[model samples]
Target: MVERLTRAVLAAPRTVLVGALALLVLFGLYGGGVASHLLSGGFEDPHAESAQATKILEDEYQRGGIPVIFKIDAPNRDVTADPVVGRVGKQLVEDLKQYDFIQDPVLSIWTDPVAARNLISKDKSSTLVVVPLDGGEDAAPGHAEDLAERFGGERDGVRITPTGQGKVFADTNTQVSKDLFLAEAIAIPISFIALVIIFGGVIAALLPLAVGIFSIVGTLALLRVFALFADVSIFTMNLATAMGLALAIDYTLLIITRYREEVAGGLTREAAIHRAMATSGRTVTFSAITVGLSLSGLLLFPQYFLRSFAYAGLAVVVVALLGSLVITPALLKVLGDRIDALDLRKPVRRALGRPERGFVPTEQTWWYRFVQWVLRRAAPVMLITTVVLLILGAPFLSIKLGFPDDRILPTSHASRVAMNEIRDDYERKLGGEVTIVITGSTDAAVDDYAARLSKVADVDAVTSPDALFVDGRAAAPRKSEDRHGEYRILTVTSNTDPLQDSGKTLLANLREVAKPDADVKFTGTAAATEDTVASIYRHLPWVLLWVAVTTFILLFLFTGSVVLPLKALVLNLLSLSATFGAIVWIFQDGHFGALGTTATGFITATMPILMFCVAFGLSMDYEVFLLGRIREEWLKSGKTRADSDHAVAFGLANTGRVITAAALLMAIVFAAMMASQVSFMRMFGFGLTIAVLMDATLIRMLLVPAFMRLAGRANWWAPAPLRKLHDKIGLSES
Candidate 1:
């Protein structure tokens, strides 16, 4: 099938090129605005209890949405005592009222003294003006930006800084865009230099980069299509571009290197393209399927953040694979003998001793010698590598998962700085206080419930219609009507970080104490974090099962061996454990301060799962690339133990250089994201870079050969029924 497709593409290279160009243009034009359509928040499970509570509050009370907070600083003056500051605050409130997007009756120091106690800074030098936006988070950023532009700096003896969910998200989106550009700017040139070194010719190097560019643009366009139907995360753009570029380089390197090898072996250009497509092209296809299947596991989670990556990853792999299989072969056919043109570094090739046409220089190559060394000491090498991986993975046992917050932004950012101030001075007053909606309840019942909640460990205070409870007592009697008048709203404050265990424990205690007849539901940042974590873990087993089972099946089809599939899965998981542990050590545990990122004390909840799927899929991608060659050699050499040994060495020698080059290219691209201002992106960059480097060198180069040597012919064994099934439907490059 691959041969037939390549022959047809080669037969009409210009036609195929034109079609590809047309699709590129169409998708680029249509999907160019994908960023505008992407969302900034997808941290909550939409159907979780917290989400349901939020919805009810938003619909009935008009109060549960994210608030736009303005930190107004009045130097050397108490905000309330200073007439100028008070006048400016009034004017700001009036200005906000003129905008339809701002909710009515904004809360500020001038509105109510009771609320003002919390809104005002402790030194009286600053105050907070909080207002809910009309369109929730999606509409808040624009309004916040407009408000900031209008009332940002030094207005009537006060400086206003916007620091809220809206401003934070807007800033994050802007930073991610800049980071994407920066990563591309750094990655592209470095990748080109590396490719030039690997291929030893400029023309040969440019082909992979061209495919990478095409794949990135095509995937972006595909993301635009997805954006039309669902809310994609802005973060997805980073994943799409990174994965697209990496996979393009990977698949192109595999195919083009094979084609060059076949051409150097004296095959006609047509036959060389056919043979390259039959072997490397088939490998690229299987690699794409395995990667696509692994990433599809992310879709099982409800968060759009994870789902968006799945969409982006699948698009990148498919588009890059198609580009490698179709366009690369077509371009190879057109280039023919000139594919090696623009050779600037001929001395290195001469030193390496270029082989004659129709011959591969395995005996003279370094990779062959390396594989020979590994084979001679396979058992010890395997033990050492496994031990190293396990030790590196040890830190993952202490990983603490939490939701991302303004801390994800650099501390130098205004929103982050302002939020830190808020967290330090007025944490008890901050809006993450847990809210409970009790339906079918009287005011007296709600008062009792609020009193009981206040007594829960870690609960700082609770507010209800009848009274305010503080330190487990009714500190003051209050009169207030439920805005909706249908359900009682009980607000509880905790002294613990809402995303951490203390706050989650307090929330659980609150739920346990609430009367079943109260018809109670909890909602807040802590509740949402709790629910999001639970939701992800609830679906995690299924996702892992799906990825494991499907990937096993895909590997079986590729290698026709159950043991190899299981072995590959184990090795990939081991490498991923190392990656996760590194993330925990560097980002969570704050061991690597040189990276210019502060530790958040917890990894983002979705990052581990997303990284596992991405890294595992990419591991499987390289697995397919290596195993395809080894499988071919095994079939050709008659599958004897001696032949199996020869096949492992020969296959490693033939493909090792390409695999290393591709891994280097991928690692460089991912590492470029470390330059990002966001801590999560840095963690992602560091984790993936480590994973690729380790997979390509230690696992693929040393461990794989060692394991195969130990397994011998057993590496190719399958049950008779399974063998018959594989014979009927399995993919073979031979």
Candidate 2:
């Protein structure tokens, strides 16, 4: 099949190249504006109670609870009765009222003084203005940015800065865009130089870049299509470009190197293309399938933020695979022999007074010697490697998971700074109110429910339509926004940090306080966090099962051996566990202060699951590359234990340089993400870089070879029925 495809491609290389160029242009034009269509918030499960309650609040109550909450500071400590403060505050509220998008009667010290007191800071120098915007959730961030541009900063006697969930989302999206550009600027040039050095020819190096560009642009266009039907996050852009470039380079390098080897072995150009496509091209197909299946595990989760990654990941894998199999082979056929033009390795060797080495004998290569040393003491190598990986992964045992917040941004960010001040000096933190809507309940029942909510530990106040309840007592008649439709609304405010354990516990206790059969719903930061975590836990098992089962079957089909698949799964998990542990230590436990962000004491819940899928697929990508060569060598040599060992050494000696170079190049691309200001991006960048390096060196170099050596002939063993099944349907070169 591969030979036929190669012939078809070789027969019409120009037509293939022209068609590819046209598609690239079309994809570029359509995908250029994809970032604008992506959503800023997708962290909530739409089926959860919080989401349902939020929809009710939006649709039934006509209330956009909070706009961009602004922190206003005055020169005088006493805000009330201060002439300048009152004038500036009232003028700002009036300015806000002019915009129809903002909800009427913006609260300030002067307008609705009763509610404004709750918003006043403890020091009396600062107060918050609550201006609710009518725009829906998708447009809230844009509205916040517009408000910030017009009404934020100094006005008359006070300084106002926008700070809330809306503002935070806007700032985060902006940062993500900046980080994506920066990561690319840093990664691409370095990658090209490394590729040139690794491929040792300018023409060969350019092929990877061609494939990378094709994959990224194509995926971006595909993501735009996805955004039409689903809520795709802006964060997907970062992963799309990163993975697209990495995978493009990976598949291209593997195929091109195999072509060069076949050419050097006295094969004709067409035969070389056919053979390379049959072996390395098959590897690319299996690699894409494994990576795509691993990413598909994310679909089980309800959050679009997580699901969006799956979309981007799958798009990149598919697009890169297509480019590698279709466009790359066509380009290789046209550039045969000339692919070695503009030779760089020979010049470097000449300058260094070293002789030109075309291809070193396999027995004398460094990888061969290294493999021999490892196989001689395989038991100790495997034992020591496993122990080291386990030790690195120990910190993950204590990991705490939670939703992201303003803290995910850098400390100097305005949103985070405002939040810090609010947490420190305000009696009631802004946007920390848990709103409950109860249907089919009488006013008396609601009053009692409000009193119960006010009695919970750490509860600051619970304001219902009737009165404000504080510590189970009716403090005063409160004219609030809680009265809407036939449903009774209760707003519960507390000082607990909503992204912390205390916040989640408070939400749980509130839910428990509600009657078992009552038609009650909760919506707030804490409620959303609780629901999202629960959703992850509920769907987590299915994701793991899908990844494990599909990956096992694919590997089994590829290797025609049950033992190799099991070993690959175990090694990949071990490598990923260590990566998670390192992430916990650095991002969660706050061990690395140099990353320029404070530890939140909890890792973002979606990160671990996302990382596991991405890293595991990448691990298998390398595994397929190594094992394909090993299996090829094994089939030709004797079927004895010594022959198996010889095959392992020969495969390693042949493919070790490509794998190492590919790993380094991939690591460089991800390492550039360490420059991101957002803590999660930095953690992702650092964690994946560590994972790739460890897998390439520790697991692939040490553990895999050691295990294969120890297993000897057993590594290729399979049951009679399964062997026959594999012979019929397996993906192999021979």
Candidate 3:
């Protein structure tokens, strides 16, 4: 199949180039508009109980909860005594009524002064005007952005700063968009320099960028098409851009390096392209499939935020695979010997008074000698590296998971500023209130339930239809909004942030309280977070199984050895564990003060899953590259322990530089994400950087060769039936 494709490509290289150019233009034009169709929020599981409860709260109770909380401050003066504050606050409520989506009765000190006492700060200088938008989750952030733009600034000495889940999500979406552009701006130039240095020429350095452009634009166009069928998260765009360039460079480097090796071996440029296609081209195909399968694990998650990565990853990989297989080869066919033009190494060679080196590496190469040294002391080297990996991974045992809040945004953001004010200056977290609904419950039963709920630890107050309860004692009569026909609603306020341990414990205790069993449902930020985390964990095992099974099978087919696949999985886990531990120490434990991020005390719920899939797949990518060359060399030599050692050393010499370069280039792409304002983006960048570097250096370069030497001839071992199966289907250099 590759031979046939190579013939078709060599026959019409110019035609292939023209087709790619045409696609580049079309995709570029359409992909630019993808932002219009993306969503800012998709972290909730739509099928979870909390989601259903939210529907009831919105439809039956006419309470959408607060999307935007406006902190109205009078600057060290009492709000009631300042005429400007009173007039502006009243007018703000009136202005809110003009928006049809805003719930009919906005909550503020002016409108419900008695019930909104919790909205006032302890000093009486600041109060809140809570605007509850009636739209569902998708439209809420857009509404918040509009409201924040219109009424979020100061009006006659009364400052109105908006903050809440809605505003925070909006800010996150906007920041991610900016970070995407900034990350590219940073990654592209640095990557070009790295590419030039690695390839040792200017012309070859530009080929990967061409592939990157095609992959990115094509994936964006595909995502825009996907948006028509389902809600896609804006975060998917960031992944697409980063992975598109990364995979392109990885595949392009291997293909070009192989072609150069073949050319230096006295083959015609056309024959070299064909030979490179048969070997490196096959590796690219399997590597992409391995990555796509790993990303498919995200589909098991109910959250669209995760599933969207599956879509983005598959699109980028497929597009990059095509660019690598079709576009890269076509460019090579056209460039031919000129691919080595404008050699960047020539100037260096001149200054050193040396001649240019050819493509072929020798036994004197650093990787060959390095592998020999590792083989001599295989056991100790293996044991020491294993211990180091385990020690670095120890911090992952202490990982705590939570959902991101306004803190995910920079502290300079308006929503983050407002959240900080409420956290420090306000006695009550009005935005942190939890709501419970019970249908067909008697007033007596609800009053009893609310009283018990109010007595739970960390519960400040509970308002039921009968009366407001504070610490199990009735304080005042409740309002009509608390009752709707036979359905009773209770508002539970806590002094702690709902995302914290105390608040989660409070919710757990509330669930333990005895109720009428009349379809009681909890709906609020805390409830949604609980359900989202549960949904992820419930399907997490299946996700891991899918990634492991698919990857093991793919590696088995690629290497024709059951032992190699098993070893690959174990090594990938070890490296990924170290990466996760670093994430906990830096992002969760707040040990990296120079990163300028606020530690949320827990990793984001989906981050580990997302990182595991991406990093494991990429780790396996290098695994395949190294193993492919070793397998080729092994098959050509006699099947003996010494022959196996020779194959390992020779393969490392041939491919190590390329693998290390690809890993270095991939790391550079992810490292650009560290410049992002969002803490998770920074975590994502730093974590991937560590994973690729560790996999390339410690796992691939040192541990793999050492372990292979220890295993000796068994590195290629398989059961009789499986060996026959592999002989029939395994990829080879034939």
Candidate 4:
């Protein structure tokens, strides 16, 4: 199969070159506007999930369905009751009271009746106000926060805590935009250097980078179109680019390495390219299929965000795979010796002539000795590592997932400074954040319930709103109209995290307190954040599980051996688990000092699973490149398991230096993300770097062969009936 692919790569070098060029042109035009024909940027980045969700909420509000809530909090409750307080405080309170778009802030003390009751506070020591914000179509919500700075009027104690559709949109956009650029900035330089170093030849390395870039552009363009039918998140867009870039390098790495080997073996440039392709191309195919299948696992999830991410991710990978195999081989064919054009260092020449190379891979190294030692203790080593991973990963078992309280912060950020002010100082005045619900019977449930709600909890405040119906239409008081019943607006406050456990617990209590007296539903930033976090967690495992299983099957089909596929699954998982531990250790546990950010309690939540899927796909580079030669030896010698294992390790030793070099290059690319201010990106960058290091060293260099030694001939065994079937149809490396 390898020979066949190499032949094909050699056979039609121009066609492959042309196709690669075309894809580049197409994708460039699509994203950067250099290529005029591929412009796909009218809407939001189609892969960014937060953008899609915001759009949905926008649509809901526009339809006159959900009332917008605008919450305000002022600091320093004590030094009150100057004439200026009545004048400025009353005016600010009045402005919100008259807002047409703003609905009753269910638990605010600043609105009409609620404010009246709370402002006097029995001793008349303080005053408060709730404002209704009803900015119609395309209200620039960011402007509202600005309103706070304006209304506070150089005063320290008065402030507004905005919470409405506009705030949500503003916060989401702010976060996504920052991460996107941060990721690009941190990744690109490191990635470029990694590419240059790994190839030793500039053009050779750039090809994969070019492929990855094109995939990013093309997939975004494709996603823009898909957005008509699905929701995409801003976070997902950044992630897809990262994913595509990593995968493209991985695919190209396998093929490039194979092509170099073939060229050295004396094939003409074209023949070498073909032979490399035909062989490495199978690896590419299997690798792509595994990655695609794994990402497809996101589809089992109910959240539109995950589903959208899955589809977009899958599309990018397919395109990257195509570029690696169908397009890349052809480019290699034409480039011939020029593929290594930037070889100013004369590395190959130095390598071929010298024997003093400390860098060259050899069994005499300490690493080789360590592998030998580990091999002798394989069972014990494996068992110990497995137990360690399980214990470290145990935190996930008791995991409580929820959207962040300060969604805008990585917890270290300062926008959260604003939230701290509200939660601490503001809560002293009102025991908790308020949740206002307008409730009533089918006749006048909303109005009556509003009044009932005011009287329910720590109701120190009351907002007696004028009769407001769900729609603008007013019901006749004496008529049989359902909306004619009395409606009173009320606000109640409580203390809670609103997104995490304490918040959820408080919410449950609040619900139980209010449910018996009125027909009411409590939905606010805190509650909604909980739902969002729950949604991601509820579906994440399924996404990962399906991705792994599907990757297993895809690998099985590619190798045509059930045993080989199972082995693929195990190695990938083992490496991934170790990676997760390292991520937790570095980012959450702060195993290292002052990583330049406050350590959140856990590895930035969503990153572990995403990293797993990504690393599994990338790890296939070693799996295919190293194992290809091993399979060849096994088929030829038909020897004992140990012999084949030795052959594999010997081939690996030959290739190990190059692959380890590549892994180092790649690890640098990932680690560059540590330069980002965004904590999650840093976590991802660090975690991936660690994972690649382990994969190249421990797992690939040591564990795989040691296990193969243990499995012996059983390693190659498919079921007996399946053996003949595979022999009849399978394409073996042999």
Candidates' C-alpha lDDT: 0.86, 0.87, 0.87, 0.56
Candidate 2 backbone collisions, by pair = none
Candidates 1 and 2: which is better by lDDT?
Answer: 2
Q: Model 3 over residues 113-207: C-alpha lDDT tens digits?
A: 65577788888899888788866556788898899999988887778888887788778878988999999999999999999999889999999
In model 4, which runs have C-alpha deviations exceeding 4 angstroms? Answer: 1-26, 32-110, 113-172, 347-377, 387-398, 407-414, 428-492, 508-522, 525-545, 582-594, 597-608, 620-622, 728-731
Residue-level lDDT of model 4, residues 1-734, one tens digit each, is 44555466557778767766787777656554211121111122222332333333334332221222333333344324455544555566566544445544433343344234433333343443433344422243444454444453433454434444344444545555566567667666677776776666677778877777777777766666565565554456655667667667777887788777777667786666666666667766766666666666666655454566577778778877766776677677677678989854476667678543334334565545655666677777776665765665554443333332243345443344444443444434322444443345343444454445444334333232343322223222222121223322233444444444555665555455434345443445444544455555666777767766766555555555687778777877877776776666655665674266555454433455567666776687667666766676566775785675566556566567667876876676567556555556566677777878888886777667677766767777777787777767666553
Worst 10 residues of 1 by lDDT: 355-364
Scored against the true structure, residue 219 in model 3 reaches a CA lDDT of 95
Q: Report how far residue 141 has shifted in candidate 2, in Å.
A: 0.8
Residue runs of model 3 more than 4 Å from their true location after superposition? 359-361, 484-486
- State the displacement of the C-alpha of residue 242, model 4, in Å, after optimal TM-score superposition: 1.7
Q: lDDT of model 4 at residue 432?
A: 41
Q: Candidate 4, which ten residues in sequence have the lowest lDDT sum?
A: 34-43
Task: Give the candidate order by descending lDDT.
Answer: 3, 2, 1, 4
Can you give the lDDT of residue 331 in candidate 4? 73
> What does candidate 2's lDDT look like per residue over 1-734, in tens digits?
65677778889998999999999999999998998889877878899988898888877776644467888887565777677877877787777877777765577767775677678888799988877777655778888889988888887767888988778888988998899889989989999999999988899899999999899899999999999998899989888888999999999999998988888898998788888998999888888889999999999898998999999999999999999999889999888779989989888999999998876678998899999999999999999999999999999999888888788889899888997888888877555679897877777889988988899988889988899999999999866667676777888988777887778788888887865235998888888888888888899999999999999899899889999999998999999999999998888888857367779899888888998899988998998899989999999987899999999999887889999999999999889888888888888889889999999999988999999998999999999999999999988855
Cα deviation of 405, candidate 2, in Å: 1.5
Clashing pairs in 3: none
- TM for every model, in the order presented, reads 0.96, 0.96, 0.97, 0.75
- Candidate 4 C-alpha error for residue 339, in Å: 2.0
Question: What is the C-alpha lDDT profile of model 1 across 1-734, one tens digit per residue?
Answer: 77788878988998998999898888789777777778788878999988988888877877666677899888789888998888888888877877777764478878866677778777888899987776765667777777777777778658888888878888888899899889999999999999988887899899999889889899999898888888788888888889989999999999888888887888988888888888888888888999999999999999889998999998998899888888898888778778789876666557779743345488678898989899999999999999999999999999888888888999999989999998776635475489888888777677777788888887778988778898768999887655356688888866677876777787788888848365788899888888888898899999999999999999899889999999998999998998898889888888858267878688889899999999999999899889998888888877799999988999988889999988999999999988889889888888899999999999999999999999999999999999999999988886
